[model samples]
Target: MPTRTLAGRGRRFAAALLLLAALAVFAHPRIEAAGDALARIDKAALAKLTLDEVEGLRSVLELRASWLVAGPLATLERLARAGIPVEVIDRDPAARWFEVTIGPEPKGDSRRPPLADARGREVPQLAPVPLEQGVWITAAVDQAAGPSTMPGSRVIRVSAAGGPALAVAAQRVIQRVPAARAEVRDDPRIAALAAEVSPDRLRTSVEALQSFQTRDATTTGALSAANFLYDYFRGLGLATRYEDFTFPGTIDGVRVTGLPATNIVVTIPGSVSPDQVVVVGAHYDSFGREQTRVFAPGADDNGSGTAALMEIARLLARGPFDFSVRIVAFGAEEYGLHGSRAHATAARAAGERILAVLNLDMIGYTDRVPEDLDVVVDTASEWLGSRYIAVADKYAPLPIARRLDPLLRASDHAPFWDNGYHAMLGIEDAVLNNPYYHRATDRVETLNFDFAAGVVRATLAVAADLAQPSRAPAPPVGPSARTGFLRSLLSRVKLTELAWSPPSDRAAVGYHVYRSPTPHGTYQRVTGSPVTATSFTDRVTSAADQVAYYVVTAVDGAGRESNYSVEVDDGTIRR
Candidate 1:
């Protein structure tokens, strides 16, 4: 009976051994397949692809097994590339699957994966699959990796429940990757070429050119076009200077000394090539009544151009450029380009290197002609001039017509061309349009502000495309202090009351009233000086005299003048 029991025990032992052998064989292939799949992964490719692609790849990897190890490495790598520093946790085979945590990697930390729960206890929850039946046993990884480990990593663990998904996520993260940096040359020649093509710089040059204007000759119109340019350029922080040229040939044989024809010039020093100059200019004078009385508010005639120049200067002031830009506001243009002639002549005599000349004249008016006005490119300087027209057409809101007119001799550019410089004139088709030309009605209200703004914008664009200099052009000069104050005060101060009033009981001065037909026109002295009287009985005029304007200036005993009272005008008087 003892022998029989022994035999049975042996049989049972052999059977158990055989079963264990078969299980080992079945499990080996699965382990190998999983290992091979993980090994074959191209980590670099994983890093280059977007997150969506990586997720899809993870799905494909997961199909081969029930559980996989993954971590937050993929996200860490992306963040690192974007200038964040990070560290990845290591893995341990003893803990069924690899483990990983993401955060700032500190020095002296073990590169191997952790294998315990959050409280430094061994996480035996990780499930191990049997080689034969694909059955998994659960086990937990230790969570005492460090305080630096991210909270998201812990959340992922809770969601994964320490299963294949967690392993897959950890594996996905383990494959940390980086993006490839693009290679580019930083050669000085290339930088120079780039500087040459910079549109902002060129625009600055154009703006600087716009900063010269003609000065008013009298106190009545306290500011001249030239003064406007000065203020504009100075406001832009440009180093501006002037050249006064005398046009002494007398008007009507009267010796007119210092018939001031001046050119306002501004220079922007270059960073690399300061010797080469990009030139731009416009005339600042306007034609109207004599240069003595009455204000010739030449706001649109060339003020538009001058103002545009000033704006350019302001734009170009903040630049790091490679070439010099020169702006000139030529005076005596209305008197026939005398100032420009002097400037161009001097430049030629000095053998100055002038690349291009952009002349802006009458750029404010946009009344007649096709709504699509042609931007005339002088046939002589078509190479650069055509580019301006083309750029304007390509970028400008308005259609720029490219015309090669034979009559481009309207402004300062003519003198530059006569001096053999490359020059182009920017003008409206003034020959056909300009109803207010040299007329008393040429006020600011008569001009199109929108059209003026467009021209300024277009001119700025063209200038930007050409000079390729750095910095914004300056603003055009404004009216003088006295003029500005007077104008501002006059504009706001309406004539509230104009009834003639008698002086009070105390002895008072006599009142001499003057009158003019227009705001800025001829004024005639009234016939009588009324004494301390409120009402003036005009004994000289009949009731038939229509349209009377009156202003009262008080004259004291010593022939001193008081402030002129408010002006009053009555409609045409009917007898």
Candidate 2:
């Protein structure tokens, strides 16, 4: 156990607040030594503190939310007890070289060079847990209708590619999450399409993305990645477009221009209601978050998800659907889901009929844990999420686990849920333990293509079912719309309430709203059901949920929906 005197605790809390206040004061990333830290503190007021204790305080300031997890478990406990916000990510294979993750040093903390190993080779995610304290760091898959303790993995097996024996290293934590009922839908059509998901092809895509050097949203690499996706989707004969966006003070605390962030979209028009959309999403951008400038082979973090999107596109072109399916590869996910927010915000404003959003993120690294797949279902997307679990059991039965973690908003899917769109995530583990996650070594070598193939298949089953194969062509004419009212649900943070004038279409029974960050990009609906009234409040989530566009369309009494009326832009930001 670690010790924490009441006075020391108060001092530590004050230090954290000071750090928050000092965020505007600090200009340097590297605090040269203990002296550098003390120079900034008011030592005169803290006569009870020792130089050594102050060094530890400096470490706290430098480390901020990050932790150096290598040393002894005792040391780690002390750091945690100190209100350092540190976490022990994972232990290495041998348990000698522990992998650690330090939280962000306040927004404007100095930009130090990237972390390096003993050889001085800069490796992202490899950092020393500054030995400010003593020794002793504190410490510390599959959907196979597995043990009934976890959800089955989303996948199908066939002629080749059996993955390695799972370590089950991370399953202990997963077991704590209740088992979800898996109902494997025996959709032969889905099986055939899933069988088409190849490990070889998936591997090829990861390799191509890894070749990009870096996919940091603020760098040119992000745009390159977007363009690459745009071309690939276009090559598949899909109508693809780039959903461009901007990052305010969010980009490393500086206003960056030409951040070059965007989400790549491939739109497949619905045969009936072309406006009703089902989104298949994955973030394309990658970053080690290792250093201000670093190489992140995000092969596992998201390369696998992006590859799945590409392969899914190939698979979808083979079939038809009644609902529109838009394949979106988002940008700036590592930088707080910038691209998805812009897209989600616009979708709400336009009142697009979004059936569901299936976000695939970090689906490759199946290194540890036996639990096959973990589906994070928030309160909003429960129905769709439960079906996703059932889809795994029905069509591609695999072990699975479910967690109703509303705050598990680490990926792109959360933004949709925040905006009231039914969305969920298909991930390898609820608490991801890919040692190379957010690291330079997160390369193709560590990826399990066979497992990735399974995740892709699972997504296909659900998306295909939701989209539903269609033999009829879409109606050339859609309903028209007119605006009613739109306002903020909260103060000025982001959430908003909107009301639209009912369309003039006489046959229409209700209205559907569509939103997009831009006027041209394919729009997505934010409502779960058709709004019986002309007024609907748009509940936008704060982090990254900046909505701008709204359009309402009349839904015919026959259930047929119309084209959008004139689009409206909401400049609701008070500041």
Candidate 3:
């Protein structure tokens, strides 16, 4: 039996290599030919082959035509490598998959009927995410679904939740799986801050925003929502401003352009590094089908997100953080992320050091047992996503699904990502789960405020962590720095020793060391985390040829930090 099994495996390996060799000669034959060859592969034989043989076939297809790799070949490769029988999934009715496309808008007669979301509701044909001009094709796979009909595209598997990729209809297919969350690092200070996220207050804000009837960016309701937010932030004794922008585009064939919109911006100053900014934003605009100009009540679509943004702004107002926090309620997001695009463009041009952006969108509806949140990120923003999940694990403790895809750019966070800032979008994981999305029926009545509060608490914790809380003891004083040499058997190294007098406050627990090239320049935290020592020794690398500035701050038991101490410099340069 073993000898026969080896013979059978040897035959399958030889056949797969021969098929790959034949495919390499195509050099861009009719795409249908390649598609037909892939479609005609013997599933039984393919499944019997080892992963190495399957990879050989996949490598040849990728080399001959990389486009095929992202399309049918990707699905085929996944199946052959997983060692699952194609017939098993083919007969299962409960098996389904989801996909979305991101690329140039297809030209001419490309419009198709709206696709069904996870719950089998027909989702609208709006561009699901923010993009320059990419089309959104979100749907479930079945007899009607197959590979993307578009010419040029790439398919990235979302995860291993659903079985193999069913016949999908979009540019990319993502299977939902349990979200990967980071280990909890409980900090009492941040926990206290997150605990203050009031569900009632969140509902109040959502109710107010929804009462406007419509906030279609170009309508009077949008301006009203913006004004309401401006006043709310102003009442918090925070700095607030209005940024007007214009969007040129159309949604659902409505001319949504040439009209002015308002974006409300609030600033929470950082006591330490004011230039290092963290943005927490949500779109205030809403969209509906016909009569949308007057009756689009985007309570869950964005009123939920906007309210969360407002609540966080209110919560963080009492903070004097290590880094600045900028809360923005963006305008005209439904029409193509116009408000965030304008803001991101301006921030990029001005050379702002934005540390991260946490965008809240559609956080109020969930029909599942455990209400979960989805953190959407591209390759560049995965770190931000990880940090968010870590904070959620400790502060919010809800199930979270982390989705990494550049094509999921249908919200305000997309603009910041486009402008090269680290940003992540916190949204509901299930696509089209809200049956009332984009309809006049999308009211606060259909929202779950408790769920919204949980999402906001996670955002608050992340934002607060990035902008270190500054409500601790007074700053350490009498800071002094000295340069020394540590000689080793192999080499001599330069070190900068910094020391400071303890603050008068008895509640102080530890100290944080910061360094800067100039006295008033941005000071970077030198310690990985808070240090309990009064003196810190930093290995001197940049200081080899020039002077450096150092300062110290005190931290309390709750993890709240104080302002910077008096600036001190190495005696190498006169101050």
Find the candidate with the highest TM-score and give its number.
3
lDDT per residue, candidate 3, 1-575, as tens digits?
Answer: 00011223455545544554344334223233222122223323432433333332221010000111122434443543454322111111223332334443222225444555568765443222211123222233432233343465432212113111111110011111123333333567889889999999988988898899999877788898889999999999999999987766554555444678878999998775577799999999999975787899899989999999888988899887767999999998887677998898789778887878899889998877578898887544565787787788878788898876655667888767655567888997535578898999898888888888999999999998777676557777557888877776766566888887787666678888887644324567889888777889988753253445687878888887876665666655321
lDDT order, best first, reads 3, 2, 1
Segments in model 1 whose C-alpha atoms lie over 4 Å from true places: 1-225, 249-258, 289-293, 368-370, 469-575
Give lDDT: candidate 2, residue 119: 60
- The per-model lDDT (C-alpha) reads 0.44, 0.58, 0.65
lDDT of 2 at 442: 89
Q: Write the per-residue lDDT of candidate 1 for residues 350-402, one digit (tens) a residue.
A: 88767677777766566753344445543334444555555455445455555
> For candidate 2, lDDT tens digit of each residue in 1-575?
12112334455545544553344133222222221111112212122222222222211111112212122334333433443333333323122122112221112112333434446654334222221221111111111111111122111101101111110111111122223332332447777887778899999999999888888777777788888999999999889987878763235555444455688989988765567788999998888767524587799878999999999999987766656899999988876677887898789768777878999988888756444887886543555667787777666666777665544567898667545566888888767678888888889999888888888888988888777665321222333322223345553344445555543334556767666543222456887777777666665443222324566666776676654554454543210
**TM-score result, candidate 2:** 0.53
lDDT of model 2 at position 235: 94
Ten-residue stretch with the least lDDT total in model 3:
59-68
